[model samples]
Target: MLIATHSGKFHADDVWAVAVLDILFPGSQLIRTRDAARLAEADFAVDVGGVWDAAAGRFDHHQKGFDGARQNGVVYASAGLVWKEYGGRCVAQLAHECCGQELPPQRAQEIAWAIDSDLVQYLDMADTGSAKNAPGGYGLSAVVSGFNPTWIDEQMAGSVEAAEEFRLNQFRRAMGFIREIIINAVKYRVGALLALDQVRQAERLEGGSVLFLGNAALPWSSVVRNEMPEVLFVVSYSMNENRHMIHTVPVAADSFKARKDLPKAWAGLRGGELAAVTGVEDAIFCHNNVFIAAAVSYEGIMRLARLALAEPDPRGA
Candidate 1:
């Protein structure tokens, strides 16, 4: 199968669209040109073919009367259009390539929806000059565009064909980079879902305002916030032979304020001084901002958590 898109200055939308297509249609020849007749000759077209017929394998979203928006209302770009068609299958294929196992049918659908919401739709917004979620506008677009050949660099190439070849090499590098990103993202997300059971089990044993995790390697913040809001402090016994950790639960995802802060006196203290002040002989350190503390044993970290809770609440009525 032949895949076609426009030549000249490339953008993130079409670059990613073509990259994903390369994965779905392995060994498919990619032709970059703006000639309508030449694009029509290919089995598939994207970005510049000016047609939005999915059945015909034409996947442009630039037609004037075309209307395609994600559930969140982000209009389709070429990346979004292609993802809508084949993203789930692509996600599953990548997962299997990375791991020798296939995702359950339900799991594949769930991850595809997430990829659309978290990644594909975001790219659409970036491509169409629409913004809702990104606070800092420059994201993946900046990274992709940075690969373009500059005037000075192009002149240094000595010929137009050489510059084009250099640009093509950059695109190829970008595709490899994009593949690693997508695969790793799905792998971690799947792993996190698998770890939720561990976090929930710890939540059951929690008492008062503290939760104790037998093992600290798991990502626990999302579980704590969504499943166990009553937990104010978490004391985790890491695999380390001699160290445990304590942390305050943040008030919100974007906020620095915690549900409860560590003792004001312990903030920024360490070693013998911290241990002396907190009266915990095994105390190791407390961060300057009091969000975290370390201790030599499980009991030592527990003491740190209790001491932090005991500290006066300046807001108390």
Candidate 2:
């Protein structure tokens, strides 16, 4: 019989679980990875068992699959027993146990009280906070609404040292690229009208950004939503003397589309040549006119511009 447990963290319970499982079935291999490829060979699996409290007679059965595995193995015991015997009180307790030292009574009591008072809920809330209001469609407004100004005042007034916190570095990097794209588009008068239209569309999409570029005979232009992480770019240019077209580029799927010109003057701007832009890197340039745009990632734009530049100039080339 094989028993497999998976967890994002190597907690004390994880170590205990492995030790108990090993004692039960010697020579069973323990494996873990952030990649899915590592689990391809496993035929059976068990999810991580949550914390168990014996003092208060409470068991956190939120995790699934443990009971079934236990029944199949004929162990048939609850998490409470597992935690009481094997789980450590805290990081310190875990370290002490590993070092062959007994956990202090005060620390043990703290862990017990933590479980009883649902301190895990606080940790869970912090984890959700780190997600930056993305979970459950909650926005910054929701977070601000629940925040306590008094707590902030207390923390600032207290003697204890406080650590500085900042938003995820990746988010800042993405925003930098967004700002560069927007400023460049505005400076070149690239897609002002289309940008406005895309902003309206994004408003309809519930605060999603859409990049728009290309119309009549202009270069690409992008528009991003104010609150969401999205980009839309559009490109439109004339392909023939009688026909004008419009094209739209979505960030995801790298998709583009073109449609035939309608009777109205703006109709020609409706359908431009469309192509999936790919392999764009740090900078994008139009070889024909030497037009260049720089950003953290411009691989998609570069590919589109190069493709357009390669096409024979309909007038003569």
Candidate 3:
């Protein structure tokens, strides 16, 4: 199998599209060219064939009269065009390889949609001039495009062949970077889906006001905030630090205001000072914002949680 894309310069869209194909069709040869004969002979033509037929493995969006857009109106670039067709399979394969789980077809499509909404669409937006690069130029699209050779570097190469060779090397580097992004995206979504049941079954304490999770690494915020409405705070064991942590449940996603905040008296206190305030001898520290606190033992954390629960919200009775 041969994968062919345009030569000269590369963008995140082309790199991402090619990377997906390369991953799905392993052992495929890659060539950088615009020659129609060469592109015609390739197994897949990406970003340069001036076509958008997925069944034929032609995934270019530069053709005339192309008006492909998502339901939300984001225009399709080569990346989006290819991803719309192959993303589910890519996600499934990555989940099996990187996460050791074979996702169902429906589940794989769900994760693919998430990646499209969160990451792929932005690459398309930037590629099509529909949106600006993320502020501070830290966006993935900008980062990937940075891999392209600069004019000075091309001049330094001193010949078309040397410059094209250098560009191809950089293109491969960019593809490697994009490939990692895809794997991580798959791993994260898969892990979150797997953790949902654990979050749902986490032990409830203090009359269900406090939730306890054995593993702090589990993603419980969305579950706790949305599903477990009665849960005001969560206590979990931090394996990394070998400590116990209590966290205030936020009122909503990404909101700073938690459903309940720790007592004002405990704010910013640490070590013996926090212990004195809470009377939990092993109490470690409380954030000044009172959204989080830590203790050396489960008993200490539970005690702090009970005290905070009994304490009135300073804003009102």
In lDDT terms, which candidate is top? 3
lDDT of each: 0.80, 0.32, 0.93
Q: What is the lDDT of candidate 2?
A: 0.32
C-alpha lDDT (0 to 100) for residue 286 of candidate 2: 27
User: How big is the positional error of residue 77 in model 1, measured in Å on the Cα after superposition?
Assistant: 0.7
Question: How well does each candidate superpose onto the true structure, as a TM-score?
Answer: 0.87, 0.18, 0.95
Q: Compared with the true structure, what per-residue lDDT tens digits does model 3 show for residues 1-317?
A: 89999998899999999999999999889999999999999989999989889988899998899999999999999999999999999999999889999999999999999999999999999999989658778799999989999999999999999999999999999999999999999998999899999999999999999999999999899888779989999999989999999999988886899888999898999999998878999999999999999999999999999999999886773
Ranking by TM-score: 3, 1, 2
Candidate 2 lDDT over residue span 1-317, tens digit each = 34444533222222333333343345666544323444444432322334334343223334445342222232212322333343333323433433334546654444433341232222223332322323453432233223222455436645432211111122223223323432332223323432455444432211322233223444333333232234322333334432222133333334232111111211112112112122333322222222222223234443443444344444351
| Residue pairs whose backbone atoms clash in candidate 3 | none
The number of clashing residue pairs in each candidate reads: 0, 25, 0
User: Which candidate, 1 or 3, would have the higher TM-score against the true structure?
Assistant: 3
Question: How well does candidate 3 score on lDDT at residue 80?
Answer: 94
Off by over 4 Å in 2: 1-3, 6-28, 31-86, 89-101, 105-107, 115-119, 123-317
Residues 1-317, model 1: lDDT tens digits: 89988777777788888888898889989777789889979988989878898889899988889888876678999988987787777777877887655888678768878887877787778788886335664577667766777888789999988887777777777777676667776776766776788888874333558988878777788888877878888888778655899988887777888888887888799999999998899899999998999998877887887777778877571
Candidate 3 wrong stretches, greater than 4 Å: none
Residue 224 in model 1: lDDT: 85
